[model samples]
Target chain A: MAKNLVIPIGPQHPSLKEPACFTITLEGEKVVNAVVGTGYNHRGLEKACEARTFIQDLYIIERVCGICSHIHSTTFCQAVEELAGVEITRRAAYIRTIMAELERLHSHLLWLGIAGHEVGFDTLLMYSWRDRELVLDVLAALGGNRVNYGINTIGGVRRDVTPELIEQIRKVADIVEERNKYYIQLALSETTLAARLGGIGKLSHDDAIKFGAVGPVSRAAEVPDDIRVTDPYAAYDEVPVTAITDNHADVFGRTVVRVLEIMESVKMIRFCLDNLPEGDIVTKVPRKIPEGEVLIRTEAPRGEDAHYVRSNGTDKPDRVRVRAASEANWHGMKHMLEGDYLADVPIIIAAIDPCYSCTDRAIILDNHDTGEQSVTDWRSLREYSINWYKVRGIDTSKIKIAYSPLIF
Target chain B: MSELIAEKQALATILEKFPFLEGKLEIQRRQRIISSALERPLFEEVFGFVTTDGGFDNFHLVIGVDDGDNLGFIYVLSNDDKVMLSLKQSAPKSNPAIKSVCSVFPNALWHERELVDLFGAIVEELPEGPTYPLPDGWPAGNYPLRKEWKVEYFDKVNMTYNPPVTAGKEEE
Candidate 1:
């Protein structure tokens, strides 16, 4: 007899941090089907961006993602700048480029650390996180904040970089660069890691393209789909970018691509600092942007971060849509999650380095309807889950979740 | 830039095939982006051509817009050289429907699902599944992304006005 056990992995699962629920059907320990649901933390940012003034929307847009804050804002600013016909100074372009690379460095380091933690390599987590602060320090000095660096403005960047600042950034980048090389060797060669992650979350090159996966995920699958390399934004054209790709096409490949890409970020930062152009950081532009629509993309550390701005010749935009890199990557997740062992679920989900949006949850029925086709809030879902376990003779009633203190 | 993707050729082929889109097509060379506004009926044909023969098959994303009288969708696709083409199509606000390109671009699944939830843009052939970017059992007719759907309107509906979901169901 083939026993099929339907398992809901999130919405409030302790192991998963993101507010996404994956309903996985397992036969013994093997996953047969997976349906990915996200959107528990929906902030209605796109709609909100439309109602507010362009200046006000910049703040809202930056909040779209915690890790890739600058990338979001920079892409938004670039679209607005393009629409306003404001050609930013060479120095501003280089500074934005430098900041972008610095962001990539910190973000990749954060992912490496998280991957380490997920895989039980806590030493890598501690070391990588400690080194991450070095990149954040450069960001703090430049943008005056570690997260949501409000460095980008409509016409150009708000901050100006001095030659001295460039040298300091170069020093930090080089140090981080050396550390990443070591990580690259470790992630690629570590035997235990290879055995654990090599074939767990396999997404082939054909599937990667068919599903339109991006950033390191696609690169790991050998798709070589990177916005930074394909279309030069910021200082990418001035400073060369090598889109690091791997053929592993699994969690291991993603790991290698990300670590090697961090090295690429270091090289980009060095080039920008050494060839630091001199000029005013910003250009004056009109407040009322002429009616036009523009779509702009930046290679966010996670994937292709795209922003579309449609103006109606007004102080406020007619529409502003932010397709965060994570949104694009989510489409491929079900494909990855299916056919993997139940034990490998956590590392597999973390392998994407997901920075999830709080939007909503869903229940997908594929032919075999379980009469659970209903939109559920956290409270009911939690109750149902607890009751579900209790019915099955496993009491999780004593599990005290600190975040949801009201779950009595 | 290759022979198939050289700026003029990529933009012109669509216009040549669909002559009605002659004035609607544009190519911004510096940014390496192009735009062509096609009718609702012509979306599948043009998109199928672009993805297959046109060599710009990378399905990036779809942006759903709420125009005053019509609903707009911009299907963004790119090629290896990084040339992006925005295939713009719109359906009348009263009808408010568009075709799904999922058969061509499998990744259009979620993006199309999002359009269905937020804008209430009826995506024909959008696989019957759970509502996306929106929770289940959300009021069927209320499309939150439309311009007429104001922030204040949220207060009247349980979608916004209801007490936080994190609170235990026992309280209610």
Candidate 2:
């Protein structure tokens, strides 16, 4: 019988954007079980919302995620708008959709590059990242910043998408479409990726549903759980989503689902641009929101991100609890990682496009136990792994290190 | 029937089957939001019926609110486009414990843990583990999400601070 060995990866691992420790118990190289420990990056955003007024929270929530900032702000605005009984203009709705889809495009591309780099394919990483800058440029052009655009307001969008901006978006979309097609082909046919990812992190169809996985991760398992289609919000009602799904139920399935969704996002952006309505973008809302509670769900690139807000007839919210898609999706990683080899950990984790920073935004707090906390940065983690092999009487000098940029 | 009427009918079916849920379940006439605040003991039975007989499969979220005297929990469940249900329940602050709903919805385990670590709400039958979403060895009894908890910055280093007036309550 193989002896049980425990490996603790991260509160600061390279693949993880925020601090989360996963204790993987292994029987030889196969993972027998795994446990997740988080809260290193919880910044108390939800509690902070209680101290800030409705308007100021738009900025605070936007900072919850650099990648999906707009969705967080939009979801907050949606819930508050519902509470205040303020109806935003039709033009504003379409503009919100455009910004959201554009954000989705950039995030998926970002994930693709990160996933590529995780599996020792730096070429795909480089290509995807360079192409991703185009989407970022479009976002910068529209919202006046590359990330955390701060474009969403209490009732509607803060900025308007001009005709010239639409033209620029279309041009960028055309280029992105071409690049995405190549990525789709490469992701499907790439020999190294196929060997590393195909049937690597399998989660059955029932497990996806049973675990209540959302967004592309669930969709890849043929669950068809896209919030944009199921519960249409913003201009999704006007443009709509086809909800791409795959039966593969593995790392490859997640890759295909996200890649196809990128194309879908591009199409949706173009459609929103073409069919955008004419009206004032912003609706005037009162400083104080009425007493009420509301739930708002937005289809973020990673999955279904939701915010539940309660107001006490005051300027500030009584409570704001956020449920990021990653939180819901985090549970399923254990199921997928079980029985998988130790080497596949990074790619398998990247397959979920896990955004620990976004998931742990509201949870980050002070670490008072400085005496006991042994901070293991990425470089040290690599060193420790290599040394662990050496200590086990295995020579590690022959292993060649591949150069991949630390994008996170 | 129109979409609006069909949605109403689907929600009506849930209320109709569970006759005991009459006064507790109220529909938001404007948005067709089916929501109710029930006693703590009633959550499992009500939620069970909502999933089994109510045709609701989508577990939207579980929100734990620190409502001063009591810790309020809102279990948001939905059935596609039919109805968005928020099952509200609360346990007294003196004894902040509620039954675990992981058996009803597996994803509730995450929310249950969040409630335990953040709001200090004791979820009965919750599996013992590390302080989730919170670091291990985090100062005991410091529930950051509680109402009175505040972050005080001294010398640009933030620390969890609660006013002396609200300190020393055993959340367990």
Candidate 3:
């Protein structure tokens, strides 16, 4: 009971693809506390944007989140275009929607692989990643690049989806759908995977609401908050969105939501391709943006990706703000990690699909005995409230008694 | 059936309810423009309208504009009905500060920070500090988004990493 052990989970951990550390405090195989350390991959993209022209900023924004690249560019473009008072053609909007959906499909598949690996299902990881490559191939075929598809411009999309590529996308969609179904069955059937995920890292509806959680995480907890349906952008208004939700509020539920969402995205892509409207991809964007501001939100694979853009009567925008979904769900990680087995920490953290590139650096860990502190797992801060509160003279029942009576 | 007509009606309704909002709030078919003094209050009203109607569930984007002498912040709010509201608020260049809509939208934190960073416009009552793409050691007074500031040269270097020192097998 007196002894304590500190284990550093990363800067290079198998669970994390990015560089970050999670310091977990162990009390005999059970993690009593966890702390997270970031700042390893801070590129300072926002600061760099100021130095670039409005057109050049598109490429920079696309790199902000590799998986959600299209959303980033679209959000940035929408903001700037609004400032410049440019209206994109209907065909361009459809193309943008299609590209965004493609990104979502690939991103979710990539996440599925990582989620699989997190729970000790390496085969699922391999298969999911292999299938994900096809989506990348499709992206390269359409946008001429896999990662930073400079398809988006201020007025509209820079590239057009040829009829032949649309046919190929349809063919690929069929193949991916068949494979996705198999994986979903495997994920649901495998007892080991189920045991690791089901009822573990539970985020209740109330907790999800309080944290302002979005994307698949909030949907899994039964919150019907999809930006596509709520804020219809691109061709989303014309197309129907059958938003997926699971009330389980667990890792398995999140997986179910994401998998189901992939199916919906495939259907959406097919619809967009079949009804591909004919028109110009882009319009003339004025060099100088009239003085104005605009707030726009688009549905990224993770959740709601919102942007705030301001421009003066100049070529460069006065200000640009990106509120990514990862930043919103970062706080929810604290609630999920507490009172769980030490082994489950990595899987739980992975559930939120955090993007450390968009968040703050430095995670602090304090030792009560020595009054000394060190950088530790960011999740431990959430557990601290419960851990220290239990030791204090404050009684939970008494506190509940005091608050419940007033409510009644 | 026209979006412009619907937006005008919606604007009329908003102005009728909040009588003090007259003249302070300007509506253009899908766009709503407002003075900077009423930006925060107007944001609440617009958000309330969307939530009630269940149409404007999506937040489009927030943009910041700097008029050499003053700063202007514009918010574009749209509903599922296709009606758009473009809201504008102007703050003086000397002390540019306006209330933040993060409390209402939850997504305004990033937008406000970008405004603070690029335009040097302060978002009053914002919980978070400035978070734009500025690098360390950049001069404080210099705001990059202004027309006066020009980029002299672009650095090609990607990122600088500080490797952590390990004390043998004991650390592992």
> In terms of lDDT, which candidate is stronger, 2 or 3?
2
lDDT tens digits, residue span A176-229, model 3:
888889877876787877887998888899778656678999899998878788
Candidate 3 similarity to native, TM-score: 0.71
DockQ of 3: 0.10
Q: Which 10-residue window in model 3 chain A sums to the lowest lDDT?
A: A399-408
lDDT of each residue in A1-408, candidate 2, tens digit only: 767999999977776666778899998899889987766778778888889998998899988887888999889999999999998999999999999999999899999998989888888888888788778778878887778887889889889977788888888888889889999998789887878889978888888877878888889999887778766788887896899999999999999999998899889988988899999999999998899888888899889898988899999999998888888888788898999999998888888887743322122234687644445543355567779999999867665423222221
At residue A102, candidate 1 shows an lDDT of 92
* Steric clash pairs (candidate 2): A39-B133, A41-A364, A42-A363, A42-A364, A43-A364
Weakest 10 consecutive residues, lDDT, candidate 2 chain B? B153-162
Q: Could you tell me the lDDT of residue B11 within candidate 2?
A: 62
Worst 10 residues of 2 chain A by lDDT: A356-365
Candidate 2 to truth, TM: 0.87
Q: Once superposed on the true structure, which residue ranges of model 1 sit more than 4 Å away at CA?
A: A356-408, B1-5, B31-36, B160-172
The TM-scores, one per candidate, come to 0.86, 0.87, 0.71
RMSD in Å for all candidates = 11.9, 8.6, 16.3
Give the poorly placed runs of model 3, Cα more than 4 Å off: A1-8, A21-39, A356-408, B1-172
Per-residue lDDT, model 3, residue A78, is 80
Clashes of each: 9, 5, 36
